[model samples]
Target: MNRRMMMLALLAWACTAAPAVSAASPPVDDAATAQALAQAETRGREMFEHDLAAERATDALLKKRMRGDSRVRGWITEPKDNRYEVSMIGEGAVVLYRATTDARGILAGATEALAVPAAPTAYQAGAAAARTLAMQSRIDACAKRYNSVVLPAPGATTDAWTVYLLPATTDPAAVPLGGSYRFDIAEGRITSQRAFTRSCIQLKRAPRNAAMIVTHMLDPTPTEVHVFWSLWARSPLYVTTGEDVIWKIEDGRIHRVQD
Candidate 1:
């Protein structure tokens, strides 16, 4: 065919192809999406709680070890039955201390062990990898000044990570406002990121332990960082998103409630 004729033929094909391509993609179901988000937030909270319990149970011990033991790099947590196991990971993939702790911070009979099993489990490996990447990220700079959390991604059995960086504050007169970030990572690469605020905002805390409301415009839905913040504060955060969706993050979980 001539060049002009070929161009017209290709144009005709393109006109016909558009509808089929559109038809191939299924429309998003909002209900399902909301449910999925709830599930993800729940899983994220679960993982965070596991690490938190371990930290509470072993922080003093870990503090001494971290200060003196050069081999201690970081820690990993795994769910074991009704309890959670904490392992102080060391150089060359060894465990300096391993023990299980319950929700109340009661540790197992084995308070300390070189947790060298036959091999590292996939769950522990995922937690470890997330911790490693988090330690290596640019976020590391802010960690010493903020409350940073690294958790395994929900629905990912392996090789996925979720990170939360929150501004830490001790001033009783000021409430550290949103200057948080949540990152979704896969196989050592960040796939997506959401920042809670362009920069940190600190509001005066007149009445302490009072309920706080946050205008979250960075995303359509509130993220796990919201949950972590609420958990850290031991207070509920009423997060209003751009879509007019109000999510309540309380007691380490997020739920949508009527505003």
Candidate 2:
């Protein structure tokens, strides 16, 4: 992964699988874990919001310069000491623009003139950075085939990736089931990939603030992208892992269900 990817581990903490929950036994949330989850949730929400702001900043320039152009590939959010660096990539496989943002997702110390284009950022400075862009572009291209929302996240270690192709649809009534995929990339190649299910599974949207129960038969724990998805959905998720261990995902954090 590059500096721009997984800039800061959400909450600067490692997410792990929580112990299983037993309905018959009353559950109590762990004090430390609960605090970590809450802190991570706040960070994730802020990251999501800031990333959107970066996109808006880049889009404004795109509209003024290359109107109706799809050469814009995608972007990566890099967190700084107390700010974020958002680089907008173009079809040339280079950063065409960059934006800096503060904590509130507001444009801070960010300005660029559309009158003169910035010199293309050399993709060769760092092999990992270049490869990251290449891999992201590859996924971006394939995303067209699956028609799912593709999110690329940094893996536990650098030079590793976990990309989620989610069935993220806006329609609240009919959830499109299927076509969701999770890909693992490392050592400059796709190491392994898995589909969440053989086909799509549609479930009704829970009311605001209500948690939806979804059975996830893949990992023993919930993935980071799941937290991001939960944040976007504006609702919480009660995910039943393969081991029947239940966890709660909300506000971009996960914790063992306290029943």
Candidate 3:
């Protein structure tokens, strides 16, 4: 079935199955309340499953059009404004998709992520300083040269930016993929910083050519910044040995949970 039809069917089911919430109403039995909650949870899961399938399908189409030889390695979806930001990883590109869906049983426009034409003057200064610090602290002798992309973070309440660094060298010995750093600027100083590196994670595995990609920035709680990513074996097959991870960021430190 088409996406629209699937969405419509799911919406109809949700509307029909939802239990009515009343003000001055009757009390429910324990079994009935539990059953209602389970049904509601089931409905929510189905909707999420449908949306995920649709998003993956869209990613595949975009990937084919942009680079036929590459595949989407991983993606993380975040809700932003009234839309969604889907950060996708391919062989050599970090593509971002801006999506508006999951409303009224319809999926609306999907397009390339829009970026500021230029960082505001003040932000440029701050980001430059922060970048220099990031390079000094994180990058080591293994990197020959690197490029960076700065984008406004969706949910950070402060003046926060996420920078992705890409290696520009032809040397195979260098880190295949580079780093992702979160920088928060305040009063011309980098108030907070956090980083993730494939080299650090791969050292544990030892002697294998490996790479890490930060696929998604997870929603935050009061005290943490969470993200999801993948680790791959840089072999002929591009084997994904480490399927997934959830990294918790707090106080300039990162802790990993493997899944």
Q: Rank candidates by lDDT, best first.
A: 1, 2, 3
- Candidate 1, RMSD to the unseen true structure: 15.1
With a 3 Å backbone cut-off (N, CA, C), the pairs that clash in candidate 3 are: none
- Candidate 1 matches the true fold with a TM-score of 0.68
Candidate 2 vs. true structure, TM-score: 0.58
Q: What does candidate 1's lDDT look like per residue over 1-259, in tens digits?
A: 8754464354334334432111111123488767656764785576457647656656756654444767766666666788777777675446677767885567666556453432456666666666666545564232245544566676777588776655666675555655666678888777886666766665443233344556677666666666655655556565667444455565665566442
RMSD of each: 15.1, 11.1, 17.8
Count clashing residue pairs in model 3: 0
| Per-candidate local distance difference test | 0.59, 0.51, 0.36
Question: Candidate 1: deviation at residue 171, Å?
Answer: 5.6
lDDT of 3 by residue, 137-231 (tens): 55443355554434444355655654444344554443343343445544345566655443422211113332222223222111111111111
Off by over 4 Å in 2: 1-55, 58-66, 109-182, 196-198, 202-205, 242-244
- Per model, how many backbone clashes are there? 0, 4, 0
